[model samples]
Target: MAEPTTSSRRPGPGAGSPAVTTPALERTRRRFLRRQRARRWLAWRVVLATVVGLAGVVGACWLLFFSQFLSVAGVEVRGTSHLSPEEVVAVAGIPTGEPLARIDLDRVESRVGSLAAVRSVAVSRAWPDEILVEVEERVAIAVVELGGRLRGMDADGVVFRDFAQPPRALPRITTDTVTRREALTEGARVIAALPGSISRSVDHVEVRTVDQISLVLGDGRRVEWGSAEQSGIKARVLPALLQREARTYDVSVPGQPTTK
Candidate 1:
């Protein structure tokens, strides 16, 4: 009875651990080694790429900042009619042989804009070696005599270039020396409101004060236009009123025009 009890159990598939072959273990080891080598290779590639990229950035910075290859060689002026290129270049003061990127474009524009004729100026780098200055010159819409010389006046009433001889077509404006500057602006405002039909007949404007302004016609006729106020209404009424033969036309009061 004791001998039979010892041998009653039988081994099943789950009774013991499964056997592993040497070939399978070797294959796993090879796979692990291959995975480790691949990870190391990827890491090296990333480091090498980062270093190369940094070196490229540093080289480009050196070329842009320190090398003479991108330095300014000269200044080119454009959009100038009354001002010479040399004049603009001199005023710009862009240092030659300096790095193009280092040139202060805003400073150059400021200096060039100081010229009386320059309305606006733009400065930029002409890549590789030059500075470009673009200027917009003021165009005169009227003329004023100062210091016995006829000076051009723009729509803004800024007295700019001096004419060698008077421009026959341009309307002349006379102002008192004590308040010449202010008077010129008022006169310009008055002229700006007049229609082409009326403006063509105007020979000159006389300003005694800011509000006291008159227009004299080519045929010795006169228009009593007081100040620049209500000029648009006055301009509209003047052409039709001029049809009446009169020595003087008064449109100072647009609603109640008068003639003599």
Candidate 2:
């Protein structure tokens, strides 16, 4: 009280410490702020990149799938023999100017396969502007008369194309009715098993039943082929037996072949 209390309220920290601030501390604070800013910038950059990438992929898909750059322009046929390419293309009915990716390959195959001459078929896009159709045509191994018309028969016993007259090159398949598929199958097998020389000389194949089969040669010679069994042996034995002058040769028992 005598010295007027000398204003002893101890100076505040800022007044006494002269507002001390170290360069190192300032630098550390600045570094921390920089790191936060950097993290935000990096996050923003990653988001932008992801959006751009997605846009690019979507744009590419649109161009390839939806655009007309890859549309079909024409249909091409391959491995066609009896049926013309135009015929196959007509049957396929592939819509021109449609996107290649949009074409249904299975549907095209089924349509082309329905042709009687087609044994097997494949359909595919030939890229750029074409659809390719490949087919295997049925080959006639024998001919059968059905409804007063001669039809070509394949090895599988399928009676396909009808003919005005039986081709001289193919063996005639004589069955009670063309609907007798089993007998026709057996008769086909008998004809298929014959040696080339014998096949060329054969005139007709007679099928009374599945097992009962016979061959009439071009020279009026008859071969009594009881069944398809032992056919390979019979084929081998027949030529040897034919060397002898005989009107009828029984190769049913190939081991004991007899000539009449």
Candidate 3:
């Protein structure tokens, strides 16, 4: 009776279920799983490599910027003529042992350029252990009386260094009233235009207003220069006019020059 009941059910495999695996198939599946595991390990290895690379870059940045390995050990000055290297370095105030990459080049340049003698300045890092500062000094083109002291004026009309006595090579600039910047600028333009031969004979430059400028020669000869306009033409004509032995030469209108 039990055998007859068992005949209604299947014994080899369950209905709608897969067949049991063979030992070879099991081994193949295990190898495939091992391969998948190896692939996963490889992916993890790539991720680990990327992380290690980033960490190395971060470490290198730290060593370069934050550590003393790239710090400034000295300050080097160049292109300094009127100012001594020590003076430039002292004013630069660049701290030694600071990170070279972090040094404020603009700040350093500003400090160095503040010196009256410096016309322009550049600051930069000089490799592993130095900060380089290059400076251009202002050249004296004329001398002006300021506060009873003679001061050197550059071509840019900036009155810079003070002198105990007027320089023999440079012409004196005098303003009728108390020194005004506009008058000085006009006088500077007039003086700058004079030929070397003519400039060498000049005694002092007279500035009344922006448009009123004149020159007095060492021989007590006066030159009426008027405004700073037509300076090149005036410069060309003055030497010839002076050859005529005039006490006063008017080259304000260079084309219609007059001598008295």
lDDT leader: 3
Q: Residues 199-228, candidate 2: write the lDDT tens digits.
A: 999999888887778899999999999777
Q: Where is model 2 poorest over a 10-residue stretch in terms of lDDT?
A: 1-10
Q: lDDT, candidate 1, residue 146?
A: 84
Q: Which stretches of candidate 1 lie over 4 Å from their true place?
A: 1-31
Clashes (N, CA, C under 3 Å) per candidate: 0, 0, 0
User: Once model 2 is optimally superposed onto the true structure by TM-score, how far is the C-alpha of residue 183 displaced, in angstroms?
Assistant: 1.4
lDDT by residue for model 1 (1-260), tens: 56655667766668495765799899999999999999999999999999999999999898888899999999889999988999888888888999998888888889999999999999998998998888999988778888899999887778889999778778888877776677778888898787888888889988887788999999999999988999989999999999999999999889999999
lDDT of 1 at 191: 84
Model 1 TM-score, 2 decimals: 0.83
Cα lDDT computed for each candidate against the true fold = 0.88, 0.87, 0.89
What lDDT score goes with residue 195 in model 3?
A: 87
Provide TM-scores for the models: 0.83, 0.78, 0.81
The clash number for model 3 is 0
Model 3 misplacement above 4 A: 1-49
Give the clashing residue pairs of candidate 2, or none. none
**Model 2 residue 114 CA deviation in Å:** 1.2
Clashes of 1: 0
